[model samples]
Target: VTIIANLELKKQQLVLPKNALREAFRISHAIAEVTNVSSSARQPYVGVSAFAHKAGLHASAIKIDPSLYQHEDPASVGNDMRMLVSDMAGRASIELKSQELGVDLGGDKELIGRIVDRVKEMESRGFTFEAADASFELLVHEEVNGKRPSFFTIEHWLTTVERAEDQSILTKAEVTVTALGKKIICTGIGNGPVNAFDNALRTGLKQLYPELEVLELTDYKVRILEGRLGTGAITRVLVETTDGKGEWNTVGVHENVIAASAMALEDALTFGLLRQGRKPE
Candidate 1:
């Protein structure tokens, strides 16, 4: 910073530890200016995927030395490396993630083939894994170990928005769950449709998953996708949730905003419970 003292030495003084970016972000969160950091995954320098490794050739090169593909070590910025498993995922990526997540893939060629094919199938249906690492982890654990993670299944649900004589809006939601063939219906009211659905869902899960009480929807974002020939267009919803312990995000793409929001919300809850090693009753 002492440019006047020595112009030639300005570069050395300007060089800063990568943690400086993280410190700035932390300060932003402290004043509530930035509601969520996970929302900025594409931000340069300190994003979750800033130093992420992909499958195939890229993953192979990174194994030899991350310096081949990355400009800097993720740790230099107080961030860790991420290896994403997706439809294009190769065996090398799976092996790397297995090592990181402690999952044993057992070196079976047929099993690895099946895993890759299944990921492709899900992706075809609009399921993405990049930002939802928790869901991906559970999927790998369940498929490789032949045991599914436990979570409640929705039987039926409905949402309604109405106006009273004074033109006040009323939003209501009702959800029913079929757990072990026992049905429980919960109805909740909120200021908006999404809020109403969330209220209903948490109210129903209260008796079963009390830990959900602490969970809150921290942020929500939606974008309209390009229209298809037969289909008009689709909506992509990204939902962030926090339980005081940590934060995670889930994404959903659908033709309807509400449906997309539902998908993200479901993934958020599933990831939250899985992280804590809990199985809903």
Candidate 2:
């Protein structure tokens, strides 16, 4: 039972221990894991998107007093409010999101303005940072540090698909990456182009950062924007990755679907490396 459900049950005079209410999200997620069922992101109190705020107007009110928008204190149910940064974000939204991600913009009005402009411009190009916090955080860090962390340089990546004589489809990918001042070439075979490319890149980098071996791609989603153009439309790819303990999302946009997937995959690995506390070479 969830805190929301229990609250409703309590209205019927059913009693639930305070400790049980405190463990609401944990219990719901634990059940999901044991049953191998995914919890809805929109589930009432425990969903990932349940407490996510996207509107700039709401963010302004939240900045003034979170209670202005929240029906109840999120912490009372083991959840925290999330301020999403998007094209519609204002200074207050950026400030709150930056603080949430532990980035110290120091309330620099000029820098926040630049970030707002960047978010708007990028969103216009089909990049949706709201769903990809890893990529968004990376963007924030790039703006704050004047550059992105360089974990490795990809010289080239290529994927090929072929139908075998047995009528089975095979995909192979080759990647050349420079890491730790060494250039390495690796190849991998998988069920799809993106999977093959992911394997090739990780196989090459596992030499320098063994911690990457634990990183796994959990979900992949693609959306075609400007669908009127059919195959020629811009493609946006969102990838979810986990390092056993936590998960994060990254996004990419390109005219070529494979290229878009490659961009998302790169960001996924880069963010995973960052999570491992490995300094860029």
Candidate 3:
């Protein structure tokens, strides 16, 4: 009976100070941090997936009326509704996602169709954007503007790992990029090729875009799309970045793990720089 009442209260939000419920999401995360116990992503009201809609049909209905699908307005609980795009998505899903990302489609059905086709083609190649909204937004920008916002252009990058006579593994990287119309070369050493590459890229750009100093890679994940292909399988890498105030994810796909990681890391920093309002050079 007690559990039932609690559930009812949560569902109805009948308490006098209903706005206080806005803290529920933050409080839940705080509890996780304090106890080091993470809640399920499917947890009602607070879960990451609670308000995520994936179906084209759902997106269609949501365009007409969001209340048609969601039990409650996500914002009421300090959460947001997300429209995910995949190969299974349709025009509606792309339209909704574009709007969510602040791109004005202007009801251009032809343009929408093009974006949808591109999304499907990319997903077929193993690039999934559901969890990497930053990458999705970049794609949308490219589609809308005819090109991606660029802060720098890579001329060349090289990473090598070596074992010293003492048996210590050392990874070194050198990156060359053009920013602000001048070529910059930087070198860095790290524990792995990806880490070394990340260090080299950031070091090269730090002088020009000092805002890069605050950006940090918080998490990384890699998946082999086809295990049967063994070492030749396409690799997908997801990189999560934080700017002290917020976090975002980006993704990349390639046959080379290092190349895949570099793609994701590039997107991550590009998104971060864009967020910082630094004009691309």
Question: Highest TM-score, which number?
Answer: 2
Over 1-281, each residue of candidate 2 has an lDDT whose tens digit, in order, gives: 55455554446444566445657777888899899999998887787777889878889899899988876666656777898888899988988999988888898999999899999999999999899989988888889889987798889989999998999999999999998889999999999998899999999989988999999999999999999999999999999999999899999999999899988988999999989998866
Worst 10 residues of 1 by lDDT: 1-10
TM-scores, all candidates, are 0.78, 0.95, 0.93
Candidate 3: tens digits of C-alpha lDDT, residues 95-199: 998888888888899889988899899999999989899999998888888899889888899999999999999999999999899899999999899999999
Candidate lDDT values, in order: 0.71, 0.87, 0.87
Indicate the worst ten consecutive residues by lDDT in candidate 3. 1-10
Q: Which stretches of candidate 2 lie over 4 Å from their true place?
A: 2-14
Q: Write the per-residue lDDT of candidate 1 for residues 78-114, one digit (tens) a residue.
A: 5667788878888777667666666777777777677
lDDT of 2 at 153: 89
Residue 236 in candidate 1 has what lDDT? Answer: 75
For candidate 1, the per-residue lDDT at 133 reads: 65
For all candidates, the clash counts are: 0, 0, 0
lDDT of 3: 0.87
How should the candidates be ordered by lDDT, best one leading?
2, 3, 1
- Better candidate by TM-score, 2 or 3: 2
Question: Local error of candidate 2 at 34, Å?
Answer: 1.3
